[model samples]
Target: MGSAVLVLAIGVWLVQDGVRTELPPRPSSAQSFPAAAAPADDGRQRATKPSIPGMGASPPIRIRIRAILVDAPVIPLTLDAEGHLEPPPPDDNNLVGWYEGGVAPGQNGTAVMAGHVDNKRGLSVFYGLGSLRPGAEVEIERKDRTTAVFSIDAVEEYPKDRYPSDKVYGETSRPELRLITCGGRFSKETGYQSNVVAYAHLTRAKSA
Candidate 1:
């Protein structure tokens, strides 16, 4: 299907809904690049590619969510015409995009990733993520053969307009990660009416 068709299949009514997603008014030059949705080749796990500033190198990260032992593919944060981050595809319900500007998975501060709870089909990679309870473990594996494990601290659902801006995108000193996707009631007019955000914290790290 075309991009527009695929978008409507989810809840993205407009391709570039938000016009200008200004980065925090700070002294950084990190530009947001649009990440491509994971190919719907199969349920097989694909390696994640990180984006580098100069070389434009593709970096890969390995992630493990202990509660579900999920090994998802991560992509760099990029924006569409509206300047909003581009989302991953609902490939077998798997595919996620990480906001690179926030923080590295194993490093300090919040590391955010966005996924589709479900597609026009029915379920997405994180369809059941809301079921994750506190204390659950979420791991992020880096190419350097190291794994960072995070524990689920909270799972919340928020309205789009009232999304927790500070809490969700705010800076922090501890290494934290947020898994976001569309949730709540659905309508033919709108695929998903709300968003589900799962918050997690780094609890362990080991050489992989």
Candidate 2:
């Protein structure tokens, strides 16, 4: 097995509370955020604010991935053992294998959602994630009924240990999204050896 994770130091958000995380080192420095600027001489320190991801002046409502619309649910976020994130389950796959965070979809940064490719059975949600083409679209629906659409810009796979940390999870200058699922082979000795990452970028967003 490759001891090298692409950039794993990986951080994934779980809730509005911003479930804290440590992401792997990034493959690209362009995605890296600078450390908080030094505080001024005043007693007050510099308040480093994280930019809202995906929900800026213009928010996305629908995304298209693998030619499917990720329609927004009346309530996109859910919790019950499975974790929370932007794109929740597809109303199937009965298992503790989902994201539990709020789902307005953070802006500017990468609003992430995750699922399991398989449990003990075999072939679960996101099992086809590797099949997503670069141009596939992912749609996210909103409260107003409008849809925000994005296109798959790239897809990269990484070994568990070598997953790039900074690039995948770091803050971005542009709004982006990440869909994650387990990939590669598993080992009784270890675990899943790789992670499948689908990278998508906004193309069209509407506020129906």
Candidate 3:
């Protein structure tokens, strides 16, 4: 299906309907790129183990990206009356929103999570997401107390008008995850013009 068709199927409309007037001012270059310590490993050790059977459907409670030192709580999100996936409340910049009705992280399908790149106050939880490289780790702690580990496969940006919904929300045989945030040039009149999406697949899972 095309981007438009997939938009409705996968709840991409909410992203397009952002309230431009509510956006905060952009951060300076220095504020946007804080230096982070390197991770001990490249987030690939989990790739060596096999995923637990039938363990991919648990609700995710938190997400951590060690490379950028991001550890944030996750809240469940649902579609609104307009058929759009609800975004995290604008007041909570540190929280990420997971599509509760969709595939859970580590499930055998694409799981979706989104966060604010920044808020009116300053940088948000995913402010550094654009800096993540391939092989970086994205660990999702689920309600089951088990952790689903994923290895970054790619990071991409697309104009909001040309979002590749099929690729972002497409079905997959292996457990996969998609992290999204607003990106690209910010416009005072239009807000952010692009969306950043990080693609990754479940490499392994560890019990609490």
**lDDT per residue, candidate 3, 1-208, as tens digits?**
1335335433332233333444423223332211331111223423443334436468999999998778999999876676666678766658988888778887777788888777655667777777777778899999988999998766766677777676677655567778878777766566677777777767788998
lDDT rank order: 3, 1, 2
In model 3, where is the ten-residue run with the lowest total lDDT? 32-41
Per-residue lDDT tens digits of candidate 2, residues 59-107?
Answer: 3333334352233222233432433233333334322221223223434
Best lDDT goes to which candidate? Answer: 3
Per-model TM against the reference: 0.68, 0.56, 0.77
Off by over 4 Å in 1: 1-60, 90-92
CA lDDT of each candidate?
0.52, 0.45, 0.68
**Best candidate according to TM-score:** 3
- Clashes (backbone N, CA, C under 3 Å), per candidate, total 7, 55, 0
Could you give me the TM-score of model 1 versus the true structure?
0.68
Kindly list the per-residue Cα lDDT of model 1 for residues 1-208, writing each as its tens digit.
1223222222352111211222111111111111332111112211232211111112337555656546677776555666455566434445667665455676765566766555555455565666677667776666667677776655766565565466555554456677766666555554456666676666666775
Error of 2 at 174 (Å): 1.8
Root-mean-square deviation of every model: 14.2, 11.4, 7.6
